[model samples]
Target chain A: MAKIRGSIVVDVERCKGCEVCMVTCPTGTIAMAKEVNHKGYFYAFPANPDLCIGCANCAMVCPDGVITVYKTKI
Target chain B: MTEATGIKEIIKPENLVYKRTKIMTDNVLSYCPGCGHGTAHRILAEIIEEEGIQSQTIGISPVGCSVLLYNFLDIDWQEAAHGRAPALATAIKRLLPDKFVFTYQGDGDLAAIGTAETIHACNRGENILIIFINNGIYGMTGGQMAPTTLVGMKSSTSPYGRDVKLMGNPLKMTEIVATLPGTYYVTRQSVHTAANVKKTKKAMRKAIQYQKLNKGTCFIEIVSNCPSNWKMTPVESNKWMEANMFPFYPLGDLKVPAEETTK
Candidate 1:
């Protein structure tokens, strides 16, 4: 079976809300979420999953060390 | 040979109790617990030793938390007035063009009052390396407001969030420094994690290389953690630096213009 490539899955719990990934993302898919976490910290979420090119921009830009990008092979 | 054990096993020619035979103990470091200054100092000492430039290396210690760096770094160091580390470095490098000179400054010292000196030095293409430590706040003066203080960050002066109306915006020194034509290499890195710590060392090494080779100005801004001032545990502050500050001051090389770097 051929692999299916898909979107970035961020662990919001681990996210420190730093927007490095947002700035580096070429596809402009990720956006800061309106909701605050238990720590009262706002985080970035995949706003346009469809627009995500699986470039690992979010992973590369994330300083919180919480983000991981799993590229689904199409 | 018999197997070595305990202190004997650790005690080797390379593992001498004292620092490099060449390093003078006149200068000592003055940083708080969990500060990244020690790590930076070790890296620099190693560079000076490896290059065998201790005799001619002139280190300029700036004002800020690490103001008393002249005490820690064993080389011949000069104390630069508040926010004038670059200027001091420029003067020494110009007078002794054959010598290796570098400046060590903190965010409060580099981004705040020393802005003009730093910009002018880089713009003039001074052949010096700047080891910039950005801990976000003015750590020396009791965690007061600093130009690099992030928004919503609390400090002695900014008890509330860093208001834009009053404090203005946080300065991204590396980004601004990279834009200068004289800058040969500019990188922004952090020492919050083990891997990043290694990267920071690599950047420092390269910055030193640029200076030793007389390429041009090399600016390495290290995004360090200030646990005492930030009022968080070492581990917590490291986490905070990674999550909140790393994004704003993204790590990686900013400028390495081939023309200048080739020289």
Candidate 2:
């Protein structure tokens, strides 16, 4: 299978650390960052980027619209 | 082939899988950390933008936590009095029959105070869409008991748990409106999970499309969560909603036009 690379951009300040994305990511790629953002909430980040298929499930369920996803086949 | 920087490659139009819809304004949402209102707002905005109805769509919202929806959704909006969104929507749809009109309202504003307007609008068969958010409690009023508060559910006013005999049962407003002859379509949905959000968005899109068809009232009730008001974390609130709200307000279409009922 061709390697599928996925990346996401998190608007940290806009994230409320609700973790809805963490649960929605099908590949289990998302995790809460240890450090809090300016809003004092631990934001979501791609903890296992290699496993991501960029299905955009997290972005679909995100209430804050803080995460943007991109994907490419390498 | 030349190697492309990560930023350069990701910025390409085809590589972008998801981005915030432009229908939403730059203003940050005022909803609490895990409030479902923000998700609902985004779905509506996205649908409007996708359908190319931004120029001709008008939204009306009643007084409640979602009253600030106009601030988040970048479109023409009218603020209606508490529980009067349906009334406002009816007038707007009537005066400007060509425009798409919809009302976004909460349980407190819809089932409780605006019950008359809601029923009358549907009963009259007004060509409009009504987006009802049922979170069980009056989230904006410090989590007071709402008309849709489930039996035995605890709220500020019902801290000891709701008493069915004393306070009455949770009103199934969606089902009630579904029976009206004027309603062309009626369904209940949620946004807790990705699948559910997609389903809700489809429902909203259908409602808007029906509005353009000059069909009667299309009512979509979203069983949402209020993490702050529910005194639960965002995740826990979703779990609680699934366990409680879903049972009382089961999802799926409650009513559909006769012609489309078979499929």
Candidate 3:
């Protein structure tokens, strides 16, 4: 079956790592990176990229403009 | 894909589901982690950019935690004295009636020092929009008790928790503004959740649309969170706000012009 593929790019340094994105993502595609960024805060990254639906819910809820989402049909 | 090739493919607009609005500057937000002000600012910028009104908007910045709004939004902005954003916005809107004029203010700035200015501007029916960020305490001044601070809410000034008899009660400024004849639309909203964000954005757009129609004043109060001052983690602060603030402030439109009101 054809599916919708989505990807998200996180600006590691720009993220304050508040985890709003992790909570807002519908598909549980985001997770906090184990390693810290230059600012010494754990940043969010797409952990299960294949599950992303590109709803942009994380970007909408993000206090800082850290997450950008892209979508394509597969 | 190679870096350059991938960049070229990504640049194709069709794949873009979401991108940061250009209305916001590249300057990193100075707000504390989990503060709702940044989310509010992004929503405002997104609406302005989507409406293509970037060139026709003028924002008035107040003296508070949101004072740096001018630095974040890449629009012509005027920094007003503490609580004087409405006065400045009034003048700007009068002179440039064609432009979309609005003020971004904090609870301390709008409901306290600028109370009179806020009341009179709405009373006089100024054709402008007012975005009020009510976090219940003075976030910029180390979380002092604000006019909107909930009863029993502890702050720097009310260390023992707000005593209603001693400190008075939290002001419902949005309700007060709705009573004025000059206000065309008045609503209380928040950015705590995706559904709430959508509502807040809709309120913002409606306020701006009414301003274009030369309708009377539009007031939108956003019940936000101040995690740093609240002494809670970002997640905990949101939870605290939902549990505490919403009961005292509540959400939804208090008033709307007859034209917008449905039978």
**Model 2 TM-score on chain A:** 0.92
Clashing pairs for model 3 are none
Quantify all predictions' global Cα lDDT against the true fold.
0.74, 0.90, 0.91
Instruction: Write down the TM-score of every candidate.
Output: 0.71, 0.96, 0.95
**Worst ten-residue run, lDDT, model 2 chain A?**
A46-55
Q: Note the chain A TM-score of all models in turn.
A: 0.81, 0.92, 0.95
Candidate 1, residues B97-135, lDDT tens digits: the string is 989889999998899899999999999989999989998
Task: Please state the error at residue B130 of candidate 3 in Å.
Answer: 0.1
Candidate 1 matches the true fold with a TM-score of 0.71
DockQ scores of the candidates? 0.02, 0.64, 0.59
Badly placed stretches (over 4 Å) of model 1 are A1-74, B1-29, B259-263
- List, residue by residue over B52-147, the lDDT tens digit for candidate 2: 999999999789998888899889999999999999998999999999999999999999999999999999999999999999999988999999
Best by TM-score: 2
Candidate 1 lDDT tens digits, A1-74: 74333356566765556455665577788887999776565677878765655555445334333444544433
Candidate ranking (lDDT, best to worst): 3, 2, 1
- Encode model 3's per-residue lDDT on B1-263: one tens digit a residue: 55445434443568998899999899999898888999999999999998889999999999999888999999999999999999999999999999999999999999999999999999999999999999999998789999999999999999999999999999999999999999999999999788899999999999888999999999999999999999998888888998999988889999988865765
| Docking class of predicted structure 1 | incorrect
The model with the greatest lDDT is 3
Q: In model 1 chain B, where is the ten-residue run with the lowest total lDDT?
A: B1-10
